[model samples]
Target: MQKILCFTALFASLVLTFLNTQSEAAIGANEIIRFSWRANTEPVTGYKLYYAEGAVTGPPFNGKNALQGNSPINVGNVTQTSLSGLDVHQNYSFALTAFNECSESAFTDVIIVYSVTISIHGNGTVGTYTSFWTENHGNETIHFFPSDGHFVSNVVVNGTSFGSTESITLNDVTEKKVIDVYFSPEKTVERDTSFPLWSGSFNENADVQGSIFIASDGVYVSQTTDTYTTNISKVSDGFCPKSGWNANYHLIQFIDVDNDGWLDIAGFGYNGLVVAYGIDGTNYHTAVNVISGNFGYNNGWRIDHHIREISDIDGDGVNDVWGFGYNGLVVAYGIDGTNYHKPKLALNSFGYNDGWEITDYRRFLDVDNDGYLDISGWKDGVNYVSLFNSANETYDNIVEWW
Candidate 1:
């Protein structure tokens, strides 16, 4: 009985060795590869996966010849499957062989995976400014389309588009007016992400054009044709030099500074000069020194800059100038028939810093036919204009009047 048992064990060992060799030889050049695979019959428990750049057969698939790495990856003792990190974009050849205590199986079919791309363009008017929006998907149909007007009406979701009825007409028509376009997505996505996705504004003659992205603040304005393209972030600080000027001597305001009924130009540039030029019905006269020695940076102790807000502040039927300077000071100067007043700083017992960073100021005509002169300023960080009651010398945060 002992002799019989030894012979049977020896025979089983020889069969196992043969099966192992046969399994290694079964893998072919092309095979559908997975990081892992299921064990078939034969008590199989694991897999050995191999890959190469081009089609090559046989073993020792290592060194630079291997697209992955130098070592032959052994996927040890996995019950049902395995995992691999391979480039999905490239065309790769792979093979999977099953493994167990006694034998292994051949590789499966070769399968491929690839990627896709998409493009977008704007249709309708090219340079003509309109609020309309249209996005073309790969298909001939329009995927994202919204009509022109208020930005609140245009909505978009995970690439899907919806339209709303809310809209605003272009009011306060001027030489240059900015029309802001906003995108208000649904609640499921995100609130802060809703922003001004598009913009269009008018030029000096009301010619329309597409606008670039500002600071995501949803505020945009047009530049006079003569003005240089300025970064949107600096627009509120006042008119920066459009062209042909120095840094300290920037053009502050373009108005009828001389009250000649026609619009004249007045600017406070470097060297404390509030220069004025007459629009002689056609061309500008050589700038006359109006308030040359009275404005701008003083000897580092303090710099009293020109008022960015320029309008008729006093209601004396003449346009007055108003500006803010360093150290929380607001200056107001009247344009007399000949010259401007030495700018008077608005005074408070506690002094000028009442959270007002004045950008531009204007006298509000009693549009409702009220008798008092109303004053207002374009302020910093707030969308609504700041209106002041000049008669009572009080400030009110009013939105409807603006």
Candidate 2:
């Protein structure tokens, strides 16, 4: 025998805003909705929250008609509870009930609503006049504003290139969306379509075969034809997926790692991770994590470390990564196709620490005219050279240059 736990009063309302306009304002799919009510006058063990798809009208608002298998969840003896991970594509009706060991109370009035989440990326922000979470299908005006000295370059919605405008009104939003707003400097508001596009610290300055690859802030890469007049910018998802590669303090190097005549991008993250992006014709794809970490050399390799040089350390005709920084720390690895072999500890330390900081003087060349590339640099006012032995793959012959 089950007895109905009677409550003096029960109320349920959306934590955000309850809009009753011509167009129902829904909630964001990724948002958490909290429901709170007045405590029952009688003694009760706890409360259970039940939700089902579609607007449940009339009758008992109970878990029997809930969408998911795990409908009514026991939220313990609390007057308030929060729930998240709701599907925005569907309408939902929520019902609450109080229960004791022997009896359960009748569910409260049903609350029907809908939801969807919007994400923003790049150098601008998004502003929706209403709450990201809404109810009825209605037009949403999303405003995009750029930072100082920057203008909206492109507005990409769900990967489709939308017009570059100050704002975009999404007519009748019904699903999850991602908005990427790329910004360009005010000076370059109008694109440069001249011959021999300007190359500086911003774009790629490498020659891939007869063509040159250009990069915009490391986020985009464009390729130029032999004539240097026609510039084609292509966006691919193969550039530095992991390793936290940023353009602020990171260094980018373009080289033919596979020796297939096509130049690839090898970016060194500030945290000692190497990310490589291969180029095919005008597109850059197949991003691979070349070096996971510094391999226990130094914590990080900054821009001044000069570790972006790609050379053949063992003279295998294949380019390798040679990096040196403060504390005489060195990190070297030989490239094998898109992957790299075990790191070759060419030189761990050069006697004194903090020596490489005296000057930006470091080189990975055949200093003594050896077949293999040697390491030569200044360590605390003293010039030293470490000759590489190709046979054993080590740097042994250490000498001082007075």
Candidate 3:
């Protein structure tokens, strides 16, 4: 009969420590992490090391998973050994085990060797200007904001030029990196027009050349002949007979309200607004109030408020109405059929009373091509995008664009 004998190899603990004053002479430019552990109480032949790059949730560790080098690294019977050829930018998880001629003991608790440093040298800042370190495979966005009269000349990433983009995102970071931003004095360049400018009769091409004008009583469209003779026709009464329409302070724009492939008239007056569909250049339906009551001049809406053309601000495919108040109040209404849905306050008060002229410098578009439209503008020496929630501070996501 063969006798079956059982022996146990138990490890009290396994520890990982970073060697402070260790020299990397044999490993060239690679780094080292020193590991120490209490030897098993029972006699064992040797210890094997197992490791991987990322966090190991709970593991029945395998030796072939080592990232830097081979795992189950035979460290003989030593209780401590220094691992070399490690990349400092990578996070590592390690476990230890003891093996004998009969069987190997269970793996010890996982020990993590994870942390990397990021060095930033620039005139601007990123993410609140704090946090100099990030976990492996983390993400971060860098925003460039040059001082007044200065512009970002170039953004250097690990000694490579990253173009003149206002912002950039570092995705899945896996290396120790250096970012340097340089600035230069702002300069203006003058250039002539790319195409020649000319004037001719508006009726030369009947379908292409026409002008729409507004009067105190109604709206009109005009066409001019070769002899400079102008002829006009009344288009719609959506503006004159319209409720709360202001003769001196009103505006109108051509828009396709119902998606019917026909042009419509959207009128904005002193106290009220309307969207009149079925405009065929000569007649249109009676203007219906898009908004219930008048937006008083002193309250939220006014004659000078910027009323933008219909756009899919919410990315719903259907065009919506957008209005920017002079006091930096932004209002948008989603469209349902020919009626505007409930109003949503996109921005409460950003740059309140700051004399922002959206018609001249501000535009709403997808500056980052993220599908949703963003409030973008240029003022003074800076070009800015309100990418996120822009409450009252207008300096968010701002960059110098010459």
Candidate 4:
């Protein structure tokens, strides 16, 4: 059952003076925001919902304000529509435009909406979310467990550290709360006669779309780790299906585009495409090529070094992705509004060009508590490290081993 929050009377009329129109309120939730408008005298096909982060004043629709989150609520001549995939506590300005058979009407006056629903985000192998009980504005408890081969690294709420507690009771949920629990995969590596414990903090960054991408022998996409055994598919079904996705799905990354409470999954496969699966909080979803084999000439960009949730490089509220390629090309994967893992060149030490002396491991630290991921790596036989200055976007070699 969907929780309705937009209208106080189940149909609060929004007074729109354009040709004298009124609309019902919007439903705000962890994953969706519903909006409704009264029917018009003229015949129309559907309504288009446009939203942006802040308030916008326009004569021609966004005269000075930049808008985002594009959707044409196509419910077939219905007055009601819900905009899904939204984050908690974010302010969104929405505007409605009617579309007929051929053309779209000018944007109507904007409506301001806020997401008061609490969101719980869990990362790592087969992530899942379960709301104990909807109190709307009271104490809430969040619990998590690592998979068979994984362990919980840390739990955070609204950017505050919540430590290693598997379950946490949020004291007051007056505002929309975002709880992110990160997990790291652990494996025992044989050092010689014995196997010592080796654990890493990977997949620590956050998402609200709650999507998990699993790439072991094959790629699996699921909303929770629990149904992974059941929801796993090879053809991608509705998500992006590639010719060889059934084969070399090596690395998987979870990202939340559009700031929605759910996370989307990015797959680094041997087929040379960074395919991403955007979960719609349900089974229906699609995976697209973030980078295809035709992209970057298929550089054979195998990911090295277990990626940790390094400190947020910028103050954008999301952790920046730092990836080291097999070719010594350091790349950063960013998400578009649609949640695609688009890689940007962060740095290139050209380790692959230098006799293919591979750089195996890398780590990130602020050192001085700055908002940048300082680079540290073990290449060839060198234990060198670099410092990141976010202001200049350059890495100063603090230590270089020859």
Candidate 5:
């Protein structure tokens, strides 16, 4: 079977610098923000910019002060313009509409940004600033990360449950305040196929604006008219990856193991940290230091590089996760649902190591139609396949595609 596997840690430096550029809020002054965008269709006289403080619930805003007040600021005639007299530290919504003598187009989707500053406690760090920063913190969402060898427990502010997620816009914290965050030792006993398979947002469009997929070196989300897409904020570990599977560690895989409807994000650096974001469906996620200290190339055995997935190999109720890396090497975490059973190097090569090689490509499929999932990929310009041996929970047999 063909394979599709695509997937950090400059940590936080530039952001911290920007956040530290100005501590005191630029309170009560007009800030100039230049705006530029594509031009409208023909027959258009000009474009109109409509803005309102906070969310734009609806029209019929107080037109009396619409022209001047920080709320409902309207301007016309120019393709682009500079917004001034903006209220500092306040969330603002803006929409654009084209106008001619005949009529005006419907206002585009409203884009909003609120002011915010995030801080972290304990030995872990979160976001760029600690507090009192002039950031347009709209929907303030920050993940809490703990130190090594730990699982985030007894977390506060970010919400309930370990590494809960909360929306700052909805939380409505008008004043600056200190949020206390904590972590705890984890009792995760790595078992074969025990850890739930990583699942994206359940209930569709609930956790994401659109469907999520990976390509090349980036994880991407596509918007469809069938449903909206999830808005992606900056994932931890920095921008995109710079190298091979090394950066894959920063790839955030989403899983809802408890089936609580909330998606938890997992980030791995192998030698570094394996972080899980948002344990519960609390609309929030924390940095959650791979504190659990399990299933990593650093803390323990090394594996799970470019790809990983959870599944039941045999009829057994237990779950198993497999990771495919370079050189046709495969690592398996054998957990019988709740406890670790057999854990070791699952596969070295599909038996053609001398000439063929597995290069960042693999997918589990029952190619032989034996009702059991098999690992398949292209090697030496041909297809190489394997089947899961229920007795030992390993992939066996090597066949080359004609």
Candidate 6:
């Protein structure tokens, strides 16, 4: 019986020793911190790592507090063996538990990691005489010149850098003066190019309310008011469809249609005569049969709509007659030596409200230099000009006159 009792005590001691050893060998605090543990006898199917800022202590830890406990927030589930997002420049506490149907391992050692954010700015300028630099994103530099085309200096922007040499010559300017700044990651680089992105000029003496006519030779100019002497004569035979013996038209120009240097007078009339008088020194000699059997007629009426005086409609060398009739129809006719070509109709639609009567039509001028000539006129108390591109045949709604 004594021997049996001794054996029983030994067996109990051995079992207790084995249990203690297993518990001791369970995931160590250091191993947990490094996430270096493999599947143990307990079969760690997953893991739960808990971390908090500040120091930790004790086995079944108690009385231990987190530095950032007041703002405790979950960093979220991560499958990786190691994790991050701990407060930089500060200590942190951590623990790991092998999660499965059975039980978890021990707590882990504390760790610390560091992190930060930053920003930067830069700029510069260039020109003949004056130069400046700025951190401001203005990114544009302006160099001005006096009327004599002399460079004006003394330019500066606050909180900026200007190179050592200050003086520059105005004669170094291009026809279309412009300086461009190229931006780099660290500094702004300036480059001067020949073409100016934007350019314009204002003429104080420009004739706005006038007729712009292009002659057969393609010379264009505006005639503001009548510069003619009217010589009225009664016609005994009725020449026009409408019964009127008082038909007369005024001469508006003398164009050298053949470019022979000598000018010819072009006359306007109301069912009367369109005589071309050749210049003979100071006096003029009438050209014979210059109007016989010609379809040219003044129509005996004037409509206040915008009239398109004669010009090259098809871009052909010869000048074609273009005008807006009283009925709001745009008419174009080719002019030969004896007769006029059939009128090509444009914008002809019945009951189509034009909003305002046609006032005039003129050759396109690309005011914006967008390579399109814009037509300008008055409509409904507003004068507007639309731009048309000859190359693309596209029209832009940029009106400007009124």
Best by lDDT: 3
Residue-level lDDT of model 5, residues 316-385, one tens digit each, is 4554544554334344343433234433456776422334322445677787787777878875467777
Q: What is candidate 4's lDDT per residue for 1-402, written digit by digit as tens? A: 543222112112333211101111122232444456777546665665566653444423321122223443345667776544444345456666666655666666666543332333333332232222122334544456666666554456677554344567755333345566665444322111111111222134433112233333333333233333332233243212333333222444444433444444445555433534333332224566544442222345433332322124544555444444443435444444443354555555534443334335666656555766576667667766677766686777447744
Off by over 4 Å in 4: 1-235, 238-242, 246-250, 254-259, 269-277, 292-297, 303-315, 318-322, 332-344, 350-359, 378-383, 398-402
TM-score of each: 0.30, 0.41, 0.40, 0.37, 0.35, 0.28
Model 6, span 33-63: residue lDDT tens: 1233333333344555455443444233221
lDDT of 3 by residue, 1-402 (tens): 444334654555887665423211122233556778988887777888887765674464443423345776878898998776655445567888887778778878777554332333334433322122223435656566666765554456666454344556776544445566654445332211221111221222222234444454555443322211134444565465333455345555666666654556676655445777743333457777775443333235655545445656665667776666654534445567476765545664333365566444767767767565677777775676666433552223434444
lDDT of 5: 0.43
Error of 5 at 189 (Å): 37
Candidate 2 local distance difference test against the native: 0.53
For candidate 4, the 10 contiguous residues with the lowest summed lDDT are: 16-25
Ranking by TM-score: 2, 3, 4, 5, 1, 6
Give lDDT: candidate 5, residue 222: 24
Query: Per model, how many backbone clashes are there?
Result: 10, 10, 0, 13, 33, 13
Query: Model 5 off-target regions past 4 Å?
Result: 1-249, 257-260, 277-306, 309-319, 326-329, 334-343, 350-360
Superior candidate under lDDT, 2 versus 4: 2
Model 2: ten consecutive residues of lowest lDDT: 188-197
Which of the two, 5 or 6, has more lDDT? 5
Greater TM-score among 3 and 4 belongs to 3
- Winner of 1 and 3 under lDDT: 3
Would you list the clashing residue pairs of candidate 2? 24-136, 25-134, 25-135, 26-133, 26-134, 26-135, 27-133, 27-134, 28-133, 29-116
Worst 10 residues of 5 by lDDT: 8-17
